[model samples]
Target chain A: MKIPKPTIKRLALYYRCLNRYREEGVNFVSSKDIAERLNLKPSQVRKDLSYFGEFGKRGLGYNVVKLVDELARIIGVNKVWNVAIIGAGNLGTALANYPGLLKHKFKVVALFDNDREKVGKKIAGIPVFHVGDLIRLTQELNIEICVIAVPELAAQRVAEIAEEAGVKGIVNFSPVKLRTSIPVEDVDITLSFETLAYNILKANPEMLKLIEEQ
Target chain B: MKIPKPTIKRLALYYRCLNRYREEGVNFVSSKDIAERLNLKPSQVRKDLSYFGEFGKRGLGYNVVKLVDELARIIGVNKVWNVAIIGAGNLGTALANYPGLLKHKFKVVALFDNDREKVGKKIAGIPVFHVGDLIRLTQELNIEICVIAVPELAAQRVAEIAEEAGVKGIVNFSPVKLRTSIPVEDVDITLSFETLAYNILKANPEMLKLIEEQ
Candidate 1:
């Protein structure tokens, strides 16, 4: 079945919500419970889940444990993915150390950078390899996912190299549009701040004038 | 006029697209040009731009410089916003050093941390203040936005404190959903990975069995 992009995102969210409930020792939760926690309507949650298959029962809502396992398999978090980060910059290093990825079964096995000073060093026990070795090491390490955290100008080239290295997917942190055959997810950090800024401006029109004067 | 959230995001994308054009010395561009670069439909671009007011002429495309200036005001990037990060861990430090924020006029003036060791240090020349001083420091520094980069357990509490400090909006990086009266933009780093994983699995169903076996 073809799932809408927003539904796919909400599926991941439902997965996380279910995991939290399972941890709290709750076995069953109605769609209303999930919707309230996520600030969405119960119908929206039920409809998104219905895209995959019938999940929640009529009266019992949904089985939290069963749904967690089902969503985990559906979202492909059931396996550990060998990952490589293409930049050894602060963002890359932070992602390398981020606990959330490993908690969800995505492991950072190696970090690639062009700087010789950083190439031989280790951060958080993950070895940093030279970018030139991406193709060879990616095969040896069986790296399936590559994280692009380089500068804007270097992002495209690095993504090309990762594709050449047979990486299955890319999670780009750069601010540039990358043209690659492989699947890529752009994490535009600055855009969120800009969106929040626009929301603030909309709420307080007076602030717009002050900002304009400055 | 009330703009849709996605349109607001696209406006930021358009702003960046135009900035790149301005840098490249491009003088004029049709909606098609911007749409092509952003991978959106031309009609979508024209419709989004039309929400604010008319910009394009009958035969002539938008004047790049003029549109860039107009978008700058509409999106509120014309003003500099003082930003505070509510955690001084790796993620917070990475955000503090990220050049993109400064490039987009969101300055990381200070970082708040509960760790006493991190509280006194500086990252990227931005001072680290104790979380205890969030209210005082927020007012003293005129911080308008707060980034929630704390661990999931501490995220909501930090957000409550930030709201109590009278910050305008929040850019949340935590996994939990935040309940606040102010506007919030979540930057869920792991959700992107999960979504990408789902896409990969959808394309390669055989991988599912292998993953399940593991």
Candidate 2:
């Protein structure tokens, strides 16, 4: 199914919050509730979900389980993915240990760091190896996707290697611009942080008073 | 200026990429190139930017500097933000040192962790302090935003405390849901990783078999 890029982004968010909504004993959720959580609009939320099908009723909201299932299927997270993280720094290790990454459909298979001393160490149970072993290990473990958390200077190079190693997808965290016609997605680490800050700043500029009073 | 939420998100990508476009001595970029990097339709890119004043000419494409300036103004990142991070664990410390967040508009002001060993220590010169000191220190430092990189259980509680302490915003990385009537924006950590993976998975399912062969 051809989903708009924006809709695809929202699918991930909907899936992420759906589990929590389930835990809270909330069986149905309106577009407004989801929008508030993500700071998005209810209309957009409804429209995005409506793109798939009518998961909601006339007066009620979407069924949590049903919506999650639909979204999961739509985003193609219905299957498992063995991920290879290409940086072993704090950010890389964080991603390796990030609970969100493993939730239900994702898995970290290996970690690659350039540092000799750090190689062979393990983070969140995933073994870390040298970046030199990326090609070898990816070939051996059948790692289809790579998460590039390396330094900015190394982003393009790591992406090149990952593509050459036959990586199907890449979730890059480097602040550098790396393009791979090989289905690589660069996570704009800094831009998101600023957006996060902007969300709060827009809501309460007076909050800056705390810093000033300090 | 009420812009569609999707437009705001895309604007972030445009601003980041256009900075590079300007640096590369490229003065004009079409909506098509923006669509390529951001993974959106060329028409969608043009339409989003249309809400703002026309930085794009009919035949000539967008002026790199002018577009960047408009985005900067529209996204409200034209000024610098002193950002404070709470919870200096793997995520916090990693975020503190993240090169992307340290760029043009955001600055890491303070780091807060409950761990005694981490307190008084500094990651990238941002001193890690006791979580207990957050309210006091944030007020003094004029921190414009708060980053909640704590564990899932601590996320909502900390956000509450941060709000009471004058924390205007939060960038949550926890797996759990955080309920806040106050101004808050939670980045579902798992959703990001999962969505990026899902998009890639669907984009190149055949590559999965390709990786096995390689």
Candidate 3:
């Protein structure tokens, strides 16, 4: 069952929101609510969910606990997980210390940094090690995922190292393009800004105003 | 100049790749390179770019610098823009401090945190303020957009605050419903994970077993 790209993205959000609804003891949710959270139309939400199966009630919406369980199972976060973040830059450190990753089936078990100063340091209790130790530590811990947050210049080399490390998958955040014999997906966190920047520049032609503000 | 959602997402990647080619003094790029980098079909890239305009030469690929400039213009990153991030949590701060933002139109001008301890602190040179100050600072600074990085519990409230601040759009990383007046749209960052997670889990019921290897 290959879900659409957009749908896959929504599943993460639904699961996250469903977890909250459960904690708050909210048992039901309307598509309208999910639509509102996602900034989509109610019809779109209903359509996306219907493609999976008829889970939400026509009037009552979705059950918080059941939806949470379903979404968790759907997103693979239901399972316990160990993750490895490659690179110890600002983005990598932030994700290594991210609170949400800890709550999911993911844990940043290992950190790899080329900077001698950064190695042996810790981000959110995850030990930073030399990139040379990637395969050795990865095999030892049976790390599941690798998050590449290195510079574009180092991305391909780091990815090759990660592939050799026996990582199950890669969550890439760099702007560089990397290829792997193994499954590797590039997700640029820079896109959010790129999108916003594009929209803003479209509305305003002169860049100097923004420059002057700074 | 409203790019489709999927195409809009890919433009950033194309922009980056084109920049690489231009930096390397490569003048032309075929759709093949774009497809290869993004893991999409060459025809798909051609079709997607076709919607924008025929920037590609008949035999040669797209002009590297020219295409990049066109895309930078289309996506609106040609200028400098200020963004306000609500919620000074790990994710919010991560986004505020995300690199390349200052270089692009996306610059974090204000950070809003409800925690008294965090309210006045500066993360990555972005000043943190109380949520109460969102409207005033946003209006004064003319924050072009807002990023919601608060917890799920406080996500909606923070979004409402941003909406009241008169932001035209939002990028919501929180997993809660956010309703807004006209002109406010949220780009949900978590959706991609959820959808992909759903597919991965469905394909491999036991994610742990599949992801784990001795």
Candidate 4:
């Protein structure tokens, strides 16, 4: 069954929410309970979860552990994925040390950079290698995902190289649109700022009008 | 007139796409040309742009520079915004040095941390202040947005403090759901990993079936 893109995103959210519930020792959660926590309607949660299978009981609700395990499998987070970041810059170094990626079972196995000075260093204990070694090291380390953290101009080339190296997908951090054949998920930092700016402006119509008039 | 959330996101994309065209010296673009670059239908681009105002002509398409300027005003990126990051960890530090933010006119004016060791330091030339001074410094610097890069447990507290400091909105990077009354744009890094994992699994159904059967 082909799930809607939004449903897939919500499944990820549900997985995280269920993990929190399990941590808090909550055994069962109704769609309403999950909805309330995520600020969604009860029916929306039920509809989204229903796309997978019927896990909720008539009165006992859905078992937190069971749903979490199911969603983890469905979202493919149950397996540990080897990841390589293709930049040793601040963004890449920070992502190398980010605890959330490891918590989600996406391990950063290597860092790649063209800079000679950073090629031999380690960020968060992960070894940094020159981009020239990407194809060889990717196969040696069994990396599945390559994170494109290089500058905007170099992003497409890095992505092409990662694809040629036979990585499964890419988590792109550059602002440019990549032309790779692999699945690319963009984490646009400027787009987030623009979104926040839009929301802030929406909250103040006078400011928006003033700016628009200018 | 209220805009759909997805349309607003696409507006930002269009702004970026238009800027790219401007940089390449492309003077005008039809909806078809814009849509082709963004991998969307021409009608979708036309409809999204129509929400704000008419910009395209019958034969000339849309003037790239004029459309870019118009979008800059409509998306509220016309003015510079002062931003404060409420964590001096790797993620926060990387965000401070991210060139994309300054390019989009969102300046990182301060970074906040509770650790005594990093309190007096600077990341990317942005001063790191103790969390105790968040309110004072936020007010003094006229900060409009606070980026929450703290850990999961501290995310809510940091968001509450940011709201109390009278910031307009938040760009939350933590995995937890914040309970603040202000607007928040969550940049869930782990969720991106999960999305990529799902796509990978979908692409290789045999691997997915083997894992699911386990």
Candidate 5:
């Protein structure tokens, strides 16, 4: 059975929440507690978990460690996946140094760039290679995922290179929309803020109208 | 008349798609065209749009410019929103320089950090201020939204400051899960990559099991 994309995303969130609970020495967590913490409804939590299988006992809450491990297994984050970043610029370098990626088992193995000066250099100890070597380096490093953090004009070309390199997935940070057969997850930071702005405006429709009239 | 969160997000995507279409001089777009470009179903596109009101003529499709303007207005992107970054780190500085935010009307008015050196510096011409003066500066600049890009340990504190400043919304880029009364939209870059990994692993379940056994 195919899982909804949103469900998959939520499973990752649930895993993160459970990890935090486990760290706090909380051994068990009720759906209600998880819901309240994540600002989700208890029914929504239960329904999302139901897709995987029965997890918790009727009376007792879920074992924090057990739930975290189960989610790790289900989300296939149990093993580290080699990741290659397509840009060696600010965003790409920042992502390369991101501690969360290593913690979550997404290892940055290589950085690719078209700039000759950046080539042979390292960002966060990850070697930077010319973009021309992307295909070769991807195979050499056994890279499974590619991150497109190049400029907007270069994003499409980099995405095509990653696709040609036979990458299994892509996490795009560029403003450009990439069209590729491999699954691409856009980390549009601006769009998230826009959504937040929309929510804020919705809550204050009068303010929104006032601004429009200005 | 509450719109689902997912639909609100999709509206942003639709607005973006319409922007691209308009740039290409495309005047009209059918739901199928929008759906196909966004990898969503035609019915889903129509359903998401129905939340606002009727759009597009039955036989003629939607006027691209009109649809773009409508979606922009609905998503509250028509006016500039004053934004402040709560960290002056690499990620925060990169975000400050990100052109996409300005394009979407989220103006980075200030950068807040505890570092004495960084506090007086400028990123992308936006002044960095001491986080201690967050509440005061927020009022002074009429800042509405705050972006949390601080480290994990500092995320919660930064969020509290933003909340105390009476910011309307927050876009958290840190790994930490912030607890606040104000609305927060997490742009967990790692979670996005993990979701991509999950989708890739799901497509190759045998490989996932093999990795699990290791």
Candidate 6:
């Protein structure tokens, strides 16, 4: 079954919500409650979940633990994924320290930088290596996922290197648009902020009208 | 006109791509080029741009500078926005140092933390304040945007504080789902990685089939 991209994204969100419910000792939750928590419509929630097998009872909603486990398995996050960060900059260093990634089974096994000084250092206990050694180290460490956190100018090159290293997937934090055979998810922070700005302006139609008038 | 949420997001991406073209001294670019760069269909690109106004000439394509300027104005990035970070943790600190936000007219003017030791400290030259002083400082600094980088447990409370502070928009980096009257864009890194994992597994159907067979 080919799931829509948006549905896959929402499945991850549903998994997170279900985990929270399980942690709170809530055994069962209605689609309405899950929808309300995620700020999504109940029908949308049901449709997204329907892509997989039917897990919810008609009136009982869903079993929190069961739903979470199913989603973890469906999303291929049930096992640990050894990952590598391609930049040792501030963003990369911060992501290395991010507890959420570790909690989600994605481990930053290595960091890569072109600077010789940073190459020997460790961010969050993950040793940084020279970019020249990315292919060798990724293979040695059994790293399947690569994160591109370098600057825009260096992003494409770094992505190419990761591809050459046989990475299966990439999470790109740089603003650059990278084209590779492997699945690449661009995590553009600026785009997220811009979307917020657009929505905020849209909410304030007067502001948008004022800008248009100008 | 009500633009679709996805269109608004692609507009930001289009703006970024246009900027790169302008930097490279490309005066005009066809929808095909833009679509190719963004990995979207040309018709989709045209449809997204059509929401605002006619941008491209029939055969001559779009003027890079004009398109970039129009998108910047349409997205409300033409004017500067004073922003605040509600956490002084590693993620917040890294966001404060992110050059992309500053490039997009969103300025991080204040950082807030509950820890007394970090209250007076500065991350990227932005002074930190006690979370208790958020409302007052946001007002004093004329901050309209807030970024929530606290842990999941504290995210909702921080978002509530930001809402009570009269923030116009929020970019939530915490995994916690927050509900507020203001527009909120949740930057869930875990969800992103999970989505990547799902796509990679989908690309390699054998892996998914093996998981299912287990």
Error of 5 at B206 (Å): 4.7
Off by more than 4 A, model 5: A20-36, A41-67, A114-122, A129-133, B21-30, B56-66, B119-121, B132-136
Pairs of residues at least 3 apart in sequence or in different chains that clash in candidate 2? A210-B139, A211-B142, A212-B142, A214-B139, A214-B140
lDDT of each: 0.90, 0.77, 0.73, 0.89, 0.88, 0.88
Q: Which of candidates 2 and 6 reaches a greater TM-score?
A: 2
Report model 1's TM-score to 2 decimal places: 0.79
Q: What order do you get sorting by DockQ, best first?
A: 5, 4, 1, 6, 2, 3
Candidate 1 overall Cα lDDT vs. reference?
A: 0.90
Off by over 4 Å in 1: A1-75, A113-133, A151-157, A212-214, B25-28, B54-63, B115-121, B198-214
lDDT of 4 by residue, A55-81 (tens): 999899999999999999999998899
lDDT of 4 at A3: 78
Give the docking tier of candidate 2: acceptable
- B1-214: candidate 1 lDDT, tens digit per residue: 6676668878999999999999999999999999998877889899999998999986789999999999999988888899999988878988987888999999999999988988789999999999999999889999999999888899899999999999999999887789999999998789899998998887777888888777
Q: Write the per-residue lDDT of candidate 1 for residues A107-202, one digit (tens) a residue.
A: 999999999999889988999999999999999999999999888899999999999999999998887879998888888789899999899989
TM-score of each: 0.79, 0.82, 0.67, 0.80, 0.85, 0.78
Instruction: Judging by DockQ, tell me the better candidate of 2 and 5.
Output: 5
lDDT of 6 by residue, B138-206 (tens): 889989899998877999998999999889999988866688999999777777799899889988988
Per the 3 Å backbone cut-off, how many clashing residue pairs does candidate 1 have? 0
Prediction 2 global C-alpha lDDT: 0.77
Candidate 5 chain A least-lDDT 10 residues: A1-10
- What is candidate 5's DockQ? 0.64
List each candidate's DockQ score. Answer: 0.57, 0.41, 0.30, 0.57, 0.64, 0.54
Question: Of the pair 4 and 5, which is ahead by DockQ?
Answer: 5
Candidate 6 lDDT tens digits, A1-214: 6666667878888988898899999999999999998777888899999889899999888988999999999989887889998888877887998887888899999999999999888888989999999889878998989999887899898899899988999999887768899999878788789999989998887877766676
Per candidate, native contacts kept equal 0.83, 0.50, 0.41, 0.82, 0.83, 0.82
Q: Write the per-residue lDDT of candidate 3 for residues A114-157, one digit (tens) a residue.
A: 89999988888889999998999988987867888777788889
Error of 5 at B189 (Å): 0.9
Query: Tens digits of per-residue lDDT for model 3 on B1-214?
Result: 5555567777887887788788889988899987886667788789878878899987888988889888876776766566888877666766776676776557788988879999878998888999888888887998877887766788777777777777767777664557765233354433433343444455445664654441
Docking class of 3: acceptable
- Higher-lDDT candidate among 1 and 2? 1
